[model samples]
Target: MELLETMLRSISAFTLMMLIARILGKSTIAQMTYHDFVAVITLGAITANLAFNNTISIRILLTSLLTFTGIAYLLMFFSMKNRKLRSWFSGKPTVLIQEGKIMESNMRKLKITLDTLNQELRGKNIFNIQEVQYAVLELNGSISVLPKPESQPVTRKDLHLKNQSEPAFPIELIMDGDIIDANLQQNDITREWLHSQIKKKGLSIENVNYAVISSNGNLYFDEYKDQIEHPVDKE
Candidate 1:
């Protein structure tokens, strides 16, 4: 009887926690801001007690979980509507570098060392700090880097090439041998047309592992079997 009671309590706690997580949305799981971190730790503690502490009534544990979730939801809703509240909750971005110069004072205030700054810059694929014109520390603890104009990648405009306009985003046409009907309808691409494109490459829908309409309106296909003369990275 005791074992059955423990099993029921565990299942009940797990179900409630899953429901709470779904209600919180992706931001709660994806980005770990200071408040989000605190809330997650608190929720885990409550869940652990609710699952194993048979002495505590299930109703009281559930009420606590629901109340906390309601408060978090209200806070998120209000933060979206008000800029000041959003800033207060998530914190503001800090300018750490400007005009190829490090803001030493700001770094000191944030308790960030020179080594930490360099590490963040390297994560942005910037090995030389001299190449950076601006770097801002975001609320999510990521460093946004702007390379110096001379160090930035050259665009077609720099080469005086003719400008061509295309779709701003790529569309997936097929995945795992299945067609994306909604994408096909939205892009005005008929299934027959896509099949013909595949046939041109001497392939069929089943042969394609993935297919996409690129931003430049080019149809690209990847087959399950790849023919490579030499694989450079094969170990």
Candidate 2:
């Protein structure tokens, strides 16, 4: 009877800890305040210790976890209910770029270096910072950018183009130098046809680094590998 009681007590503590964690949900280190993050970690560690410590009272652990969770829930609820409070806790979005100009002051405030900002801009295919109209720094420490009107690519609406056919389905061609045979067969394309295309680029299908066939029958291939030197691993 004593053994069964101990087992039941441990199981109950485990269940209680899990329930509290589930209620709190997920948030990144950048999103969570220092106090909130520390509290969550401390609560989890204490609960873990309590689970293994048979002598420590389960009531104490349960009470503390429940209290931490309840407070978190209340704070989240309050953040949602009040606009000013939400802004105060979560922070206002910082405008990094306005009217195609970089706001250096805002960037400094966010503590994000110019190199990191430029890297993100390059990922979005905006090579020149001057091309960007507005880039807002979100609370999640991510940038959302708007390109200048003059630099914006022409859309179907801009061209006055109307599509009568069904939406195009993306057809996978080559992934990491490996030809997707299933995609080729599904798209009614032959291996010989693919080889012909690769040969035109002065390469073979086996040598292709990456390629894709868009739903609109547009073939994009990147066969030539540019050698990038890495100081850490390079001889």
Candidate 3:
């Protein structure tokens, strides 16, 4: 009974620690910023101590969990409330490339190398560095690529094509297993409309993976046929 009680307490502590991480913010686990590298190290240390300390009391476990959660929640709240605080907590984006030229000073300051830049560019489907008009290294450790003007694809507007209609913000009627009523309401569409469309597409709400309505009345959709879900991959 004592062993069982210890097991339960350990599980509870570990679960609470994870719950705090989730509430803190969304970040790609595959990508790590400089701050994230430190966080990973710190979390490993704390969790390792908790795991090995067999004689540790339940009070200690709960206290540590609460303290960690409270501090993170408060910091996130403050960051959201104050721009200065937000900037301090989360550094501003750095321009890695400007006007087809690498920002060497900014790159070096961020410990960014040409090889790393190339890797980031390859992830964005741009093979040639010269093709990049602007590249911003985001605080979240993702790369945003802007192609050079001549290298960019020709848009309809560039060819003097007139599109005189309000753009549609695609409504997701269903996600995973939940029906999104709020999305339908915002689009001024009814549940019945969604039901009919799903039926016409030979897809039930449960089978519908994703759906979107483009500005020009283009209906785009993807079915979540796979049981496994994946998070967004960052460069």
Q: Which candidate model has the greater TM-score, 1 or 2? A: 1
In lDDT terms, which candidate is top?
A: 1
Write model 3 residue lDDT over 1-235, tens digit each, in one string: 7677667656765776577567655652454444445555665556655655667765675576566556656656776566557668767778898767899999889899999999999999999999987898887789988787567677767588553443232345664445667767877888788778888988887777667775357766677775457866673
Instruction: Please list all clashing residue pairs in model 2, or write none if there are none.
Output: none
> What local lDDT score does residue 123 receive in model 1, on the 0 to 100 scale?
94
Give TM-scores for every candidate, taking all chains together and pairing residue i with residue i. 0.63, 0.52, 0.59
**Stronger candidate by TM-score (2 vs 3):** 3
Model 1 has a clash total of 0
lDDT of 3: 0.69
Error of 1 at 167 (Å): 26
| Residues 1-235, model 2: lDDT tens digits | 7677667766876787667656665552346643356666877777775656667677787777677777776776676566557667677778888766788998888788899999988988889998887787777666777776567677866577554332244566876676778879888988898888888877877668778776456787886565557535431
Question: What is the lDDT ranking, best to worst?
Answer: 1, 2, 3
Superposed Cα RMSD, model 3: 11.7
TM-score of 2: 0.52
Q: Which is the better candidate, 1 or 3, if ranked by lDDT?
A: 1
Q: What local lDDT score does residue 147 receive in model 3, on the 0 to 100 scale?
A: 80
* lDDT of model 3 at position 15: 77
